[model samples]
Target: MTQAAIQVRDLCFQWPTGASVLQFCSLDVPKGEFWMLLGTNGSGKSTLLRLLAGLLQPQSGEIKISGQVGFVFQNPDHQLVMPTVGADVAFGLVEEKLSLAQIQARVHEALTAVNLQLLQRRPIYALSGGQKQRIAIAGAIARQCEILLLDEPTALLDPDTQLDLVAQVRNLVKSRGLTALWVTHRFDELNYCDGAFLLEQGRVVDRGAPEHLKQRLMQ
Candidate 1:
């Protein structure tokens, strides 16, 4: 078996308000693979992503991640905090205590990788939704995370922007060998995923290659 980049075993979670979400959920994501998580609203897709990111603790389970992880929340506003684009991209490196020159070099490289070099000095508020999303991605890349998790990354974009973002993510995964777990309701988007898991009422009901799951769901 391939070594898993992420492993979850018998996971369970419930909100503070007594709302139960996941139960007995277990999954493993192999390194360098792109997996799409499909489910309807309130179906624990976002919750599962949070668990993978280490932002939320499972009530009763174990989650093991082999390397650093980057998470892009459903709301860009939640992830983009710095006032300027450059600062935001550099935020992750602040803890490293790198020299100013080194930070600037890494910031420039990360921005250019996402095709956001021209907007380096721009204010965050002036950016379009797609641009903001790319900036968020750039910030994640700057952190040098081996795994990227996104929750509804293209939810609010126009069709063109949506396609562009999807292509960008796919390229990131292929070129950088980054493991990705993307959660979205659009079943069509699974065409880009190597494998997929179907979530129903917080549990993984079925899982397989995208085409197989599609056929099964349709039948």
Candidate 2:
């Protein structure tokens, strides 16, 4: 069997007001593969993604993820902290003990990966929505994260940018040998994934071939 990069077994969670979000949810994404999570609103897809990213703690169950984790928010404005592209990309490395030269090298490599190296000196405010999203991705790459968790990274972009972003991520996964779990509602985005999971009422109702899941939803 293929080894899993992200593994969750019987995971459970609820809000402080007692609104249950997950009910013994379980999933496993094999190493070096790309998977998408599909669900209607309030299906606990975002909650599950946040839990996997460690942004929120589950009340019960287990989440095991190998290697470093990178999270891209649905809104890039919510995650980008620094003023400039280069500064923001390197921001995550602040907690690491790397030297200045090493940090710069990492930032360069990451920006290049996202095709944003030329905009390194650009201000965050001057960027379009698409560029800002790419910068957010570059931040994760700079951290050398082996796994990526994106919660609707294309929601705010135009149709063209959305498809482009998804294609870019697929290439990144294949070229870098990284694993990714993206939460999305757009069925068109399904074409780029290796597999997919359908979330309903906080549990995974269907999973496996992306095309199969797509057809199931359409019918």
Candidate 3:
């Protein structure tokens, strides 16, 4: 079997208000696989994504990741902080103590990868919602993370822009061999995924190819 890029074993969690969320959830994601996570509101999809990103600690169980992980949250505002697009992409590299030359190179490469090279110097706040989300994606790519996690990445995007973003994501997975887990409520959005997991009431109730799962869901 391929070594799992991400592993969650017997995971459990709850909010401070004593609302139980995840319970005995276990999952294994292989390297370079594209996995879509589906669930209704308050069904622990976002919670599980946060746990995998190491942003939230599970109350019980073990989580292991084999490579650097990048997380793009539902809201672009939470990820983009620098005044300009260039600065935002270079932020994480600076933290890694990369030299100025190296940071600039990586930033340029990431921007070009997302087809946003021309927007590097633009003021972040002046960009449209789709542009801002692309900037966030560039920043994550600049980090050189092998695993990319996105939560409702295209929720607020127009149809055209959403398709563009999905294409970019697909390229990242194919070109960089990046492992991705996308969480969303829309089943139609998952046509690009290699496989999928269906969650109901905080547990994974089904897992299979997206087409197969869709057939089962319809039945």
Best by lDDT: 2
Candidate 3, run of 10 with poorest lDDT? 184-193
Best by TM-score: 2
Q: What is the C-alpha lDDT profile of model 1 across 6-92, one tens digit per residue?
A: 888888999999899998888888898888888878989999998888788888988999989999877798889999999999988
Question: What TM-score goes with each of the models?
Answer: 0.95, 0.98, 0.96
Clashes of each: 0, 0, 0
User: Per-residue lDDT of 38-140 in model 2, one digit per residue for the tens?
Assistant: 9998899888988998889999999999999999999999999999999999899999999999999999999999999899999999998889989988999
lDDT of each: 0.87, 0.94, 0.86
**Candidate 3: deviation at residue 16, Å?**
2.1
Off by over 4 Å in 3: none
The full ranking of all candidates by lDDT, starting with the best, is: 2, 1, 3
lDDT of 3 by residue, 1-219 (tens): 877898888899999999999998888888988888887888999899999988899899999999998988888988888999999999878769788899999999999988899988999989887888888878888998899899999998888888778777877888888898888767676788888888887778888888988888778
Q: Which stretches of candidate 1 lie above 4 Å from their native place? A: none
